[model samples]
Target: MNQTIVPDSQARGLLARLPATPRALALLARFDRPIGWWLLFWPGAWAVALAGGGVVRWALIGWLLLGAIAMRGAGCVFNDIVDRDLDAKVARTAARPLASGAMAVKVAWAWLLALCLIGLIVLLQLHLYAQVVALASLALVAAYPFMKRITGWPQIWLGLVFSWAALVGWSEVAGSLTLPGLLLYAGTIFWVVGYDTIYAMQDREDDALIGIGSSALSMGRHVRMGVMLCYLAALGLWGGALWVVRPQILALAALLPIAVHLGWQVITLKEDGIDPLAKFRSNRFAGLLVFCACIVVGNA
Candidate 1:
């Protein structure tokens, strides 16, 4: 009998079309789900672009992008290894390589190691200070998979992990963390919280049944307002970050476009079916809009 892949499979994109063997490995790394890596890469890009990289920082941006994809893939593989049972229980994740027994645990470990090696190569491309800052996230990354089992607001932990690139990116350019860098990190945390909550909405029912916890369940009927607050806080902090970089009144306005995009997500979001996932994925563009804002502020 064929496996039941569930509704979220539409988001699988090209991964769903591959032959079963390689597809499982691709799914394990979430290669088909470019949005995850894009979202992960953006904060770093925003930081670099904000530092006025222009043509000079293009190579650094490329390295950061490679690091994002590799490390994000490694993180997913590690998360799956830890959450295999949980993923099997969740309808949306039931067909994942590890969850469905399509990939062996030993093989997953090898694949994870391979991905981490790529991340290590990218890490070497960073400066000494940036390298240390990047390595500091290892402990946080190791702890993330267990957050959901222990806390109602696991997305908060995820925010810490996902937004870590701000430190790395800024350090790569500035030699250490700065006022703008810290604010950028803090702002990206709120953005992650908002979007991951939206993504969590898809598994609300299954998560509840499986005795799991998430921000979506914690927020309950106040989901829209909760996301709005997260976005608002993100814009406020990010706006401040920009202000510190270049203290122009108009510098603050750079965030307006993405703020509007985030607002659209909140306004159009429905708690049912794919609305949440669609809103979640739309964040890739949201991230880009903010990067553009950073370019304007940092370069101008």
Candidate 2:
């Protein structure tokens, strides 16, 4: 029988040189996919940039990137553990380490703990207020894996969890969460929903067969419209965030580039094959555009 590789696995080059045990563990944490960490890191960076910490808080951005990498790995490990059975039933996921029995649950839990330890170190680097804000996201993270089983809009719950770094980044720099921070967080939630829906397109048939829910499945033929609305809401909220900080007309224009990029994604989106995956990965670039916008608006 041929080995089925997970379609999105980027485990090659240096990562491919690791031994079987380590490779399986790395894949379990999704270290093979750098895009996940990039997506997870961008929101915090954007918040810090928008809050006017673009220069002075450079070290904080680095620490947040560390935290994002660790925490996102931990989350992926936890999610794979919880979804192992479900994953086994999905063709796209059936090759995952946990689903394929390449890694034991106990070992995955151990790796999860190791990653969380790294996250804890990064969390300690923040001030008391920001630390508290960061801790508050634990509940959201803990509940995320089960969202698919119980709700059609699991992406919304994911939005809440994934976009949480906005609050952390803003509070760490500004010493409190304010309207601008809240708006950035809200906009990031919509962005997460939009892109994650695209990612879910790869699993629609398997997800339906397995009786799980996803935004892609929920929207059906209207998926493009759904993503467009989500992108529009994100741009509007982000514009509000920038305006709250600078309160000038040009501040809003900071969002124009990202708006156009998102528009391009929607305009060219294809619901099948590699198009969805390509568009989903393109958000890494999208995140950079937003970060540049934030820096421009906040520093002006």
Candidate 3:
């Protein structure tokens, strides 16, 4: 009896050799973008930490993580599918799987359904109140794609959709909503608006050409100042949330790092640079920094 052991590299190679379309489909789901998952996970984590220090609910965290990945992907895919035609017209989005025709609409829809099913499983794990909070986000999610077509401030809509997890997270842990949770949700919204505006700057030219609306285009030459003000608003709301939760000076102090990070991002941002995408991606770290502040204050 001969037994063979496969090396890790060889196993990976074999897997890589398999048909890659499904893998590509997963990528289109934004599985590759950990930023989305992180953004979704932090709010829930903050709520759990701030809910007076019970045993950290690892199972709930795990479920929320899974839900975030699935739902964020579903949202992105839906956005891409809806904007497939418009995406093809934009330089930055032209190579997207849907826009490039690498994936069929039917196939994308199937993938969307699969992701939504995963989200449903996660939702079922939540308390009834949390479930209701989660379900209420459906309208925001459904309407998000159309905002860029109709309004120059679609970042505001994205804020509402993306930061909704703050509410869900708080409700999950506390079994009810509070002023702190609502303020955190609002703060997260402004943060999303600020960072996403930075993300949108990369496409300002294409957006202008294609007649798509974004804060980037709306602010135009004043983009930097606009982003700065948005960042300030985020900080203010976050500070307010901290005050409501802990009412401590340390909570306010914890915000200093995040404030500096936001300042650095705005001061160093180069809208005309050759690598706006890299700059935009850096906001993942910014989000992480702010989240760290939230966790520190919440856990303290």
Candidate 4:
């Protein structure tokens, strides 16, 4: 039986040449899939830029980026540990390090701890207020992997998790969350819901067979419309965020490029095959577009 090999597998080329011990650990953390970290990083980037930031803000963004990478790796490892059984049943995930028994549970836990240590180092770069806010997300992050079993919309829970950097970024800069920051967080939650729904497309049939819940399965025939609604709401709230930052009509126009990009994604989305993955990964660019808008509006 052939399993799906997304471009992010670790059992290939140089990665495969690594010692078996490290290779299994790397695969468990999904270190090859930078898209996850990139998606995780963008919200914090957007918030920092939108706060009328300067050089110090750029430095902070660097810290947040590192935190995203480390924490994202940790999250993936934790999720793999939690979902090992389910992953073993899914064709797409059957080869995952933990699911395939390439890595031991105890070792996976140790790797998770190491990555979280990296996150702690990054956290020390932030202020006390930001540190507190960042640490508060632990409960949400801890509960995320189990969400799919109990909720039809686990993507919603993921949105809350992935979009958390917005709050941390805003607090790191401003020392408190404002209306604009809240709006940015809300909008990013919608954006996550949309992109992750596209990602869930690959698992819809398998998920149904296994009785797993997902936004893609929940959307059913209306998956396209569901993604479209999510993107539109994201744009609307982001627009409101920009307006709050600067009450100028031109500030609203800052979202034009991002709007066009999301429109393209929604217009071209397919429920099957690589298109969904392509569209889901395209959010990295979507993030950059939003960051540009935030820079324009916040600095105006």
Index of the highest-lDDT prediction: 2
- lDDT per residue for candidate 3 within 177-275, as digits (tens), equals 989889888888888888888888877888998898999899988988998998899899889988888898988998898899888888988886344
lDDT of 1: 0.90
- Give the lDDT ranking, best first: 2, 1, 4, 3
- How high is the lDDT of residue 94 in model 1? 87
Please give the range of 10 consecutive residues that has the lowest summed lDDT in model 1: 1-10
TM-score of candidate 3 on Cα atoms, chains taken together: 0.90
In model 4, the Cα lDDT at residue 267 comes to 93
- lDDT by residue for model 1 (136-209), tens: 99999999999999999999999999999988998888788999999999999999999999999988999999
Model 2: per-residue Cα lDDT over 145-240, one tens digit each: 999999999999999999999999999988899999999999999999999999999999989998999999999999999999999999999999
- Cα displacement (Å) at residue 121, model 1: 0.6
- For 235-256, candidate 4 gives per-residue lDDT tens digits of 9999999998899899999999
Top-TM-score structure, candidate number: 2
In order of appearance, the predictions have TM-scores of 0.96, 0.98, 0.90, 0.96
Each model's number of backbone clashes? 0, 0, 0, 0
Task: Candidate 4: list runs displaced more than 4 Å.
Answer: 1-11
lDDT of each: 0.90, 0.92, 0.79, 0.89
Model 2 compared with the native: what TM-score? 0.98
Error at 111, model 4, angstroms: 0.5
